[model samples]
Target: MLDFAIFAVTFVIILVGAVLYLYPSSRRASGIPGLNPTDEKDGNLQDIVNRGSLHEFLVSLHQEFGSVASFWFGRRPVVSLGSVEQLRQHINPNHTTDSFETMLKSLLGYQSGMGGGANETVIRKKVYESAINNTLKNNFPLVLKLVEELVGKWKSFPEAQHTPLCAHLLGLAMKTVTQLALGERFRDDTEVISFRKNHDAIWSEIGKGYLDGSLEKSCSRKGHYDEALSEMESVLLTVAKERKAQRKQTVFVDSLLQSSLTERQIMEDCMVFTLAGCVITANLCIWALHFLSTSEDVQEKLYQELEDVLGSDPVSLDKIPQLRYCQQVLNETVRTAKLTPVAARLQEVEGKVDQHVIPKETLVIYALGVVLQDSDTWSTPYRFDPDRFEEESARKSFCLLGFSGNQTCPELRFAYTVATVLLSTLVRQLKLHKLKGQVMEVRSELVSTPKDETWITISRRRKHGEQQQN
Candidate 1:
């Protein structure tokens, strides 16, 4: 089933590209107002391609059409909802993290549920969720220790030294995720570095390989990619075996070992958590720091909140809720960056968004980018203002889109905790400043990132007594 899902998606992508090349236009199938296919075979795919990404295309589509819109991917009609009202009508309570699961499985070449029964599948998912949740609760001290180590590294730098924000955060995320997810072996810098190298090799080929048939076309790329994947699986398998033999229940792999999952199932879940957790956590921290650097007032306000809430003390899990402003900053960063800009689901049964009837099995897109920056929903939506989320209604609206609240997926919730801990620690100590004339552009993809290597310089904040003496 997993393999078929992967193949079907890849086939559709190729088929869409082929059809778009052959045909020039497609008519709308739903009542939702949106673009007709620019080409008959391609549908609106060429338009999406021309815009560079789905997020950009949807932004323009929502602007032209309205909150509810429709488009085509080859011959299949896609319904996109760009407003809270539209999403409320379309959102289903039973929606699981199937998309995230599928993407991770495809990227890692992990075929899940091979010969496993439905009960086993359900148990495996429970284990996966339990591992993450338990890690956050049980291993938070380890999390704090790792983040403070990052802070210590930054402090060691000479005052006002330029730092590569993305690179450093990615490293921090890798350490934290691997240590908590895989095992304590990742505590070694050497191990983390090797894991990251293999991770990057596989990540670089994610959409380029089996999905597009490039892996089959390029022998060398395929060989290197397979080698990296094999190395990663080997590492995960070793960790699982160690945990099972030792009967350890300290880390994420231990949780999986406690379950009845096969070695393959355990390894795949670890891979999914590692991949998603690192990327999302790294990007979230990067954006938070970038935005804080650009706005002195917001940064200062955040620092003040930290001081007022946890003076001369470290941020702990118990005190997280008290640091409400920190949560606001993280939420606003997610909104402003438009991180994870697009999410999709296949309509299980016929659905209705407003008056539009979405056909069963049709593709439904949640145009989160369009909704995040919608002027009607947010005041000065483009502005980096954390105060905007101070409102309960705003937070509720944000949660409605699956960015936060109980609705947020486990990986994202983990990220929020990690970002909160990092921000609370870093802001209280270092004063972050953007490089002069640095212009950062958002590259919306699986996750949003700076279009280029973003550089920032930091200076140590003066102590309260030192300021008074000065």
Candidate 2:
């Protein structure tokens, strides 16, 4: 009897040890609170699906687990920081690259030597940043021309016509980003429409593919996505090849061609810029217009700021900085829209957050959307009040999340300038009004966009400086 008991005890110990080794729970990761893997292979993926999106998942996780939480991403464990305090502990401004780049690259399935190593990443990052800066500085006139074209289209519409705000802005943003980032080839309507069609197909699939592994499961869907992506690549390749042969560097693509980057590297970075630039710019402008439509006071204040800054002249790049109230409105729009819901950084080495030790090489998420809406961080977090940003502390808090300052991505900086030019030009000439009984619902994915087509009406402003009646 004693011998039998000893053998049974030894067998149970081995089995338990094997189980723990194969599946380490969140408790094993740290003292932080979070969900464990529901399935041995899937981890918390099903939970993410149940919660709708990664953004929504983080929202619920932070709500339940306080400022810091941990959850398994397949076999990998992810730590999410959802408060300014948690972010401050984790962010190192000196670090060259961030989780946003890493995550974006993964989602796009971009395979290149870009960001392959520390030194390569730093060099490429600088070139990419310079490209955007040069494009914006050299191409301000092009931006104005595009904005003017959009304003002209709006002017041609009937006074009470219900305008498709999201669609119109998306097309405008695509045209602006494509022309500025790619080349004047985008100036042709046929090329722009073709590129936009391919872009929409690819973008629509990317987020859904990343979340559910649906692309791999559905062969037809994956094939269509690849076809669209191939078309986009073809367009970029032709443009890049053309730019390489040209003597003068004119647009964003020209900057890349002038660099020592390989053709593949150039394509990778340009793809990043083009995809992120269009989506972010379009959604930012959409939310800005939607918010403006809902608030007449905000709209009037913005117009007054524009009037004071430039009575009848258009928004110039130099004049952009002087429109402080306009900047606040954009800042508030980003905050309220939660434009980018989440960004992640791989923990280079083991790090500490408050009392917890983050594992080395762990994927650390900056739950930016949650932090943006945190009641502790903002007063009446749901309110779309631009006045809140008038305070220095509010701006500082925003900068910490990588929305502003040196940390802002190249695309975001470019988008802000484009948005400022577009908004300032539009608001000065038109009175924007929301359609009756139109309820705007947010569909938060890689970007936060309206769930349905948003419609608005516009009336021309009088030359006497009087606001037009909606």
Candidate 3:
């Protein structure tokens, strides 16, 4: 089911693209009046594409088109909610992570009975969350070991040299997730490398399907995606079969395999999360670093918080809470960078948010990028200011649609755990400096990244002459 749906989406998208080329999409709104907050502005495919960058384009749409608007991606109609109230009304109760429960069910092969509301599934998710949280803490040593290697390499770099943060962070996230997901076998460096390549291929193809229409037009590209997926599933299935009876196993895949779901369902979810974690977590880590490097004051504050809390001690679960400044920095980075720019949810039932009437089965997208930067919600929405999060009310009042941990992004806390550990460990040893040409520009995708590779230079902290012992 997962495989078919993946290909089916690609095929349908391609067909739609062809149809649009032969016959341009009409300007008339398929949705109701207030539904298009854009007020029936320029939502043509030509305009969205002509804007060059979709992220910038959406930002413009919200600026020009009111807070609510409807648009089309090929034949698919989409409604974007960009304001705090609009998002709150729609997303607070109606938002979902990775689309709605039914989509997740169908894509992940959950039987009709299991759903987001299902007691058994909910219990299983909670159990997995607890287990994973504990494992991340107990497993700090593994994370630190990797961090030390990265730190060592950074310390080796000459002053003012550039380092590819995206590549490094992606590697760190992939290794950390795999080691936890497939223990013992993680030492298989060759297998780990294979997973990374295959993972990147599929993720890239999915992103490309929307931009270049290659997945729909090119059979070879689609075949490549299929092949990479097969390789990934084989690795996951092998790990699951090997560790099925290993009660000591406690990674994500192990938890899913132990659940009441079918074997195929477990395998699909494992594959989805493995790649999902790498992409989103990698983006988060790199963006956090970018924000830190750009702001010397914020960097010092983060370093001070680390020293004040840990004082050269290795980062651990207990110390995580005290890293308040670190948490604020991450929150600020995600908001400023708009790491998760776009997420869509299907309106299962006809509903109304404010004056807008949403029809059943409509795709309601929340432009987190727009909401995260709303002038009404954020005092200086465009600025990179972690201190804004200094006020507890800031985080509470403003709903970071896609980054919120509740339903929009279930993996946020998980990403937070991974990011906090990485930041605390590195900030303790090195002072992050932005490279000469490296500016943090948002390159939006499934998960956003800096427009260019975020290059940063590292130097031993002035205060900490010698690195403290773990």
Candidate 4:
């Protein structure tokens, strides 16, 4: 009996040793690269996604890890590219796999059933380019018309102690975009206004839910989002149906109807395009105006450029080229504010960059905000200097990644044109001032915008007598 017990004990010890030796922990003896599993604190991945400080965290990581760094977001490996050169190489137009729709579907639950196929993508790009070219040819009259409408509405308002300029600007932007896109205005339409309100609310909630990773929750907010999307689709479908019956094709929606897509497909595309254009362009205009309100020198310089080129005559499409400074100001605003801060793509197939193989299905984010503000690439990176774009060399370096990149969205050109028109019209007419010492605070959602209740006061520019005295 004693000999048997000794043998069993020895066998058990040997088995236990073998098991420990073969375990994964023992094999590697360390955590995986880009993933720190042993850290007691919340990992950097959680820090970036959940903490709501992605911008700050990315900047810090870039500072510590150079232009390229590997990080994980919820067990998913994320490779952040911050160099302009690397970004340019990666954003090849031929890589249709890295499309905006695909990325957005993953991020925001947007479904692109309209089938923007490879050929469709090419055609869409041409359409957008044509639209922009047309805007450059004919936007001034449209701009003046929109501005006149906005000024009339502003004048009619009670001049209350605090007029919500953000709301007012947003309304104006929506009207202007709608007019430009469809050649029809819906500013005062009750149904359109309600649609705008609900759409904005739902989209804002969706953005918050996406960042919070709570989109799956079947809560009241989710219901709101569902309802908003349904309502928007219904409205768009109704429009499509009516236009189809009339056989009168005019605007973007009409063009979409004429495309090789079904009515439902056309409806969905129209909804997405219109909603995106309205929201982002509106927020951009608001932010740009907010910035101009604080910087008197910048505002004055813009006014001078407009006045010098326009010379008391209403701005014309022919005069857009002469407003070069206006374009610089708008470009600077986009770079500094970054309406769409982070653009994402997915590796459809295995690819190698500098001998580092990215496996299939890797998520790649080109941090545009970081790249635009990189000190190495931009001089006085933080300062709002529009003059940087005045030189051809500098302009080439400053990539407006808003349009025609791998992650390009279809509405970018339209947004740019609308912004240019709005800025030109407003700066030429009004001297904007922030109320007292109130500073604008930025809030980032689908697009970056000012915090709630942000206000700016506008007064007409003085005559030459007052200007000379000042």
Candidate 5:
């Protein structure tokens, strides 16, 4: 027993000594200039393992460390950026290749395949753009129809009761996006519904596991993710098989079948498109509605804008560009809420910025939540102010919220359209109000949403006679 105890103590001492000697921090007493790893005092390390809440930790680091700071997740070194200018510099097309997408591939356990070579990346971008154009052209009416359906459902509920904005938005987004991307044949099909539910469940688990630093220990989550992927592949494969049999060519599945991508690649891309669109679009709409409920003035202003442009007629794709304030509101909501808060990347080559040398293969993170709210970049950062985006200069700076440049999300165009159409329809027809004295708490999981599920009482607007009576 004495010998075993002595051996264990010696082993621990040797292990600690080895870690101290070989760790990246040990190799250099000080980090490269302009970039230093966040210490324990900044709450960097603790944030990773804490119950999946990273917003406060990230905000604290930015307040303390300025734009660039490094931190460790176990043995992995991560650098976080808080400035849009610095993030833009790193994401320049000339400098890198789809950093976040590459990181996503690793996270999803897909083969990198030479990081989707430059040519392939460019092709994919064009294909994605074409897909967006096709989807909007073919499905805007369907999206509006879904909105109408939701509104009809809302009207049936008692005026004293509030609708579950988050769940309703999630269901609407899933139905609309699935119908648009996969076509009506699979829209409400049992297999499709099952695939979506299982995939969403898995993704939610994976996101929670990652934020909690328990991704490796989440065998159930891993199983769910793997099962979801397999089921998704089966669905897409069936679609491909059906399309081939009918000699019919639709946009998404047909495009995938014709591409040089393998079966797995096709499945992954399809999954990314379908699942990402649902979560992001749904969350964005939910947050927008939540804010609108709290800010009656903003909602009235938006209604006026919608009235001026849409004029009580059913919304069409052509009128989308004319709803300028609606667009701004969505932009501000995304900026304030930051649905996709932090994006991670790995430096593929050694790069120099200011006084620091970022070594190759180092993990870099761009905290959109921090950068979007930086005092230097935004005025009245905490306020829900859409007017700030009315100016050209402000809009230009706001472009960093991921709609322009090479780093932009491929589905952003689609997301914007979906959100605008839905918001315009709802605000124009419904009088939505927050429950009295109810404070909606923001919850951060895969995305930020209201904690209590964004309960809001919505009623159809009266046709002037009822308004006069009131």
Candidate 6:
């Protein structure tokens, strides 16, 4: 009997060891709170995916499981830092840049030695920032030009016509960014038109379905993607060659030409920024219009700011700072829309947030959208009130992630500047009206977008039109 008991104890010990090794994610984040195992009845992947909009689902997680929560993204454990404290601990900005930025670099394959390693990456990053940073003045005219083109196009349609706002916004942003990045050739090149079509096709077919392997699984899409991507590469490479030979101008492509990075490197960076900027900027315009369409009072206030700031003068850098209320409207727009709902960072070493351990090389998500509207952080978190940003104390209370926080990304700033330009131009001349009986639902894509067409009628703002005519 004694010998049988010893053998049974030894067998149990071995089995327990095997189980722990096989399912390390369970123990890796056992201390964190999240969905009950039973709640995830259909497996973690399916449960999270089916939870309606990602914004709503994340809000539910924060409400039910507190701020710091963990879940399985497939077989791996993924922790979401949903509280300000959790974000501070895990997202030590002084030590590392935004994980979302890093994730972007990795996804766009920018980190892969553009010919070298850390130094190469750093050099390219500096070039990108420098190229874009000095362009507000240079780009403003291009933006105005594009907005005028868009305005004329909108006016061509019959009165009170429903134009697809997202598509138009996408064109405005794409034209602006590409013109800034590539240069004057964008104005007349036939390849520019071809590239835009390819870029949009990639967004519809590949951008939304990238993670699910649907991109790779569908032979038809895969072929279409490859052909489009290849053609885009050819066009960009041709442009790069021309830029390399030309007078050294200060455009993004010119700055890239001055770098030691390979042609492929420059092309990829341009592609990434153009693709990202198009989606985010377009969404910004779409949501800002949607909110303004529903709220006439807000529109009237915004128009007042534009009138006070410019008084029929052209939009310029010097005048931008004086439009505080327009800035507030934008702040409110980003807050309500949750433009970038989630951004992930790969933890290079083991770290802890709120006593919860983050294992090495684990992908950790910063729930910016959830934190932005956290009841503990914002007053009347669900309301779309721009005045909330009127107080300095409100901003200091919690970080707005990529919006106005001190550590906000440059891309976000670029989008903000572009959106402001568009709004200033439009609001000064047009009045936007929401479609009657149409309810808008936001779908979680690479960026969040309305499920229904952003249906709205645009008419010239009567008073402003009279001012313009005079």
- Answer with 4 or 5, whichever has the higher lDDT: 5
What are the runs in model 1 whose C-alpha is more than 4 Å off?
Answer: 1-45, 74-76, 98-126, 205-227, 467-470
- Write the residue-wise lDDT of candidate 4 on 1-470 in tens digits: 99999999999999888865543222211111233312222224455555465555666667776666666554456676677776766665325533444545565454433355556655654544344345434544666687777766654544334557678777776776665554453545775587687678667765556554455455887777778778877777776777677775456666665656666656655665667777777776777777787799999998888778887776666677678888788778877786666667776566555435666777777677788788878888888888888777567656435432324465554666666667776777667777887876666555667777678776666667776321
What's the distance in Å from true for residue 197, model 6?
Answer: 3.1
lDDT of 3 by residue, 91-199 (tens): 6555323442333333333442344554655564555455556556557678778877877888888766778898899888888888876776876788789889998
Model 5 per-residue lDDT tens digits across residues 88-182: 67766333344445555666676545255766666665665566577678666788888888888887787778688887888888787777776
Candidate 2 has an lDDT of 0.86
- lDDT of candidate 1 vs native? 0.81
In candidate 5, stretches whose alpha carbon ends up further than 4 angstroms from where it belongs are: 1-21, 25-47, 93-100, 111-116, 404-407, 463-470
lDDT of 6 by residue, 200-278 (tens): 7766653344533346568888788878777777877888888888865757777777777678888876776677777
- Give me candidate 1's TM-score against the actual structure: 0.85
| Best model number under TM-score | 2
Candidate 2 similarity to native, TM-score: 0.94
Q: Candidate 4's error at 171, in angstroms?
A: 0.7
Most accurate candidate by lDDT: 2
User: What number of clashing residue pairs does each candidate have, in the order they appear?
Assistant: 9, 1, 3, 0, 0, 0
Q: Which residue pairs collide in model 3, if any? A: 36-69, 37-68, 37-69
After TM-score superposition, the amount by which residue 385's alpha carbon in candidate 4 deviates from its true location, in angstroms, is 0.9
lDDT of the candidates, in the order given: 0.81, 0.86, 0.70, 0.64, 0.70, 0.73
lDDT of 2 by residue, 1-470 (tens): 99999999999998899888786752345657788878677788888888888899999999898899988887778899999988987886326775566678777876424646777878888999999999998999988988898899999999889999888889888988999888888889999889888888888877657665557778898889999989888878888998788755878999999899888878878888888899999999999999999999999999999999998898888898999998899899999999988887777778999999987888888899999999999999999999999999899999888888888877888889999998889988888998999988888877898999999999887767676556
- Kindly report which residue pairs in candidate 1 clash with one another: 19-41, 20-41, 20-42, 23-40, 23-41, 24-39, 24-40, 25-39, 25-40
Mark the 10 consecutive residues where model 5 has the least summed lDDT. 34-43
